[model samples]
Target: MPKWISLDFGAKYKLSRLKLWFRGDLEYKDGNYPTDWDVYGSNDPNPDGSWDSWTFLHHFDEPYKPSGLPHKQYTQEDIDYARSGIDYEFIAIPEAYRFYRIKFNETTGNGAFIIITEMTYWGKLEE
Candidate 1:
């Protein structure tokens, strides 16, 4: 089974960039990060309880695979990286969407769960 999270921007916007952080300042060996996933955008007026009328945005396949002792254990750099968050810029999307979603694949984590410490987005309003 796959898991996902949805976001309602309350209005339409031509999204440009997305910033994300996974499990900040915590044990990294918990296998609580997404390994494979995809992002989607939707403008359907009634998209609740459904996965319909969505436009594909991006796919993340192990975008950041933690390796080595420091990643498993503790390190100032690792903590800082988690705290700083990762940025992803979209590639020229002309469509503006009021809703966004991140759908996870079966390969997310070993424990079948994901932990996102924080997230943010940047975009301009659409007509």
Candidate 2:
């Protein structure tokens, strides 16, 4: 079972990179952030919500972002990184997909909720 957050672009586009910023739990010591998750792409005109339906883009297990450690203390770099956001660029060009989705499988604190400051998709519209 996957809890997919789907996005429809209305048309195909060749994707470039993904930028994300988490600003939900920064106030807390051990804030909530995605520790492990996945990204998927799809051009299926009609998807049926099956594991085999979406295109597996990448399995993100080691995304270097930022963190507070030792005694729930955040560094200057950590603060900046969180505020500026991080980019996850595609190593190679991927096929155009009109629709994209994210399956948020897990998070760092595994708290009751997760907050995202922003989510930006970098790509060029397909002709």
Candidate 3:
């Protein structure tokens, strides 16, 4: 099954950045971290039916590696770093969106599951 998550801000806002944190786990780690993902934004509350209005906000050509250390051998600092989500800065676009979606295509070790500890988005409300 494909993995995805969506968020509705309830009202349109000028988004600036997004943050994602990975779960701290060494074993069964295939799906613990995402290797490829994309983010989309839309003004429509329901964008699943048609993605025509959804704008492609960002895409990762390469997987994100939170810690430089190996997955199984993570130091305390590495674990702490992983727990703290990494920030993804969005383009300086003035568009406002009420809906946001994140799609994950691949994970660490290519496991069948994807694990995320937390997710956060920062932006200003549309004036």
Candidate 4:
């Protein structure tokens, strides 16, 4: 459910092509409004081994909707909701980052979804 992610290029990364995907509901629990989401560099890990600098690239609130059964995974259904859906949003990382971390504010609540069905991070491999 709640986890951290890292991507190391071992060189440099294209800030503009940074992308991510999540298959299920990413809605935080009650009052768990993430103040901001961040991306950091492992090369610049902090004292706690967490990425440093990790700039705020971008964040989304209810990015996408689905077609067909409105499920978590991608489907072949070409419904209008699918086209207008934004389940995933691309963000530009900083140019100097060698490793990155996606951070979000944590919260707790009953009958809430604290899970990330699926996630992905990819782009033009930097070298």
TM-score of each: 0.75, 0.76, 0.74, 0.46
Better of 2 and 4 by TM-score: 2
Clashing pairs counted in every model? 0, 0, 0, 5
**Clash number for model 2?**
0
The digit string of per-residue lDDT tens for model 2 on 1-127 reads 2245888889988888888877744732333456567777888835666656678776664346366353345677666776677678776656888878787776655554556778998889995
Range of the 10 consecutive residues with the lowest summed lDDT in candidate 4: 26-35
Who is ahead in TM-score, 1 or 2? 2
Model 1 agreement with the true structure over 88-107: per-residue lDDT tens digits: 78888768999888888844
- What alpha-carbon RMSD in Å does predicted model 1 have with respect to the real structure? 3.4
Greater-lDDT candidate between 1 and 4: 1
The predictions' CA RMSDs to the true structure, in order, are 3.4, 3.3, 3.3, 7.0
Provide the lowest-lDDT 10-residue window in model 2: 24-33
Which window of 10 residues has the lowest lDDT sum in candidate 1? 63-72
Tens-digit lDDT track for model 4 on 25-52? 3332332222234555545655575434
- What's the lDDT for residue 54 in model 1? 75
RMSD of 3: 3.3
lDDT of 1: 0.70
| lDDT measured at residue 83 in model 2 versus the true structure, 0 to 100 | 67
**Could you say which candidate leads in lDDT?**
1
In model 3, the clashing pairs are none
Where is model 3 more than 4 Å wrong at Cα? 45-48, 61-80
lDDT of each: 0.70, 0.67, 0.69, 0.44
lDDT, candidate 3, 48-114, per-residue tens:
5555767888776333445555544555665566556666787775588888878787776676678
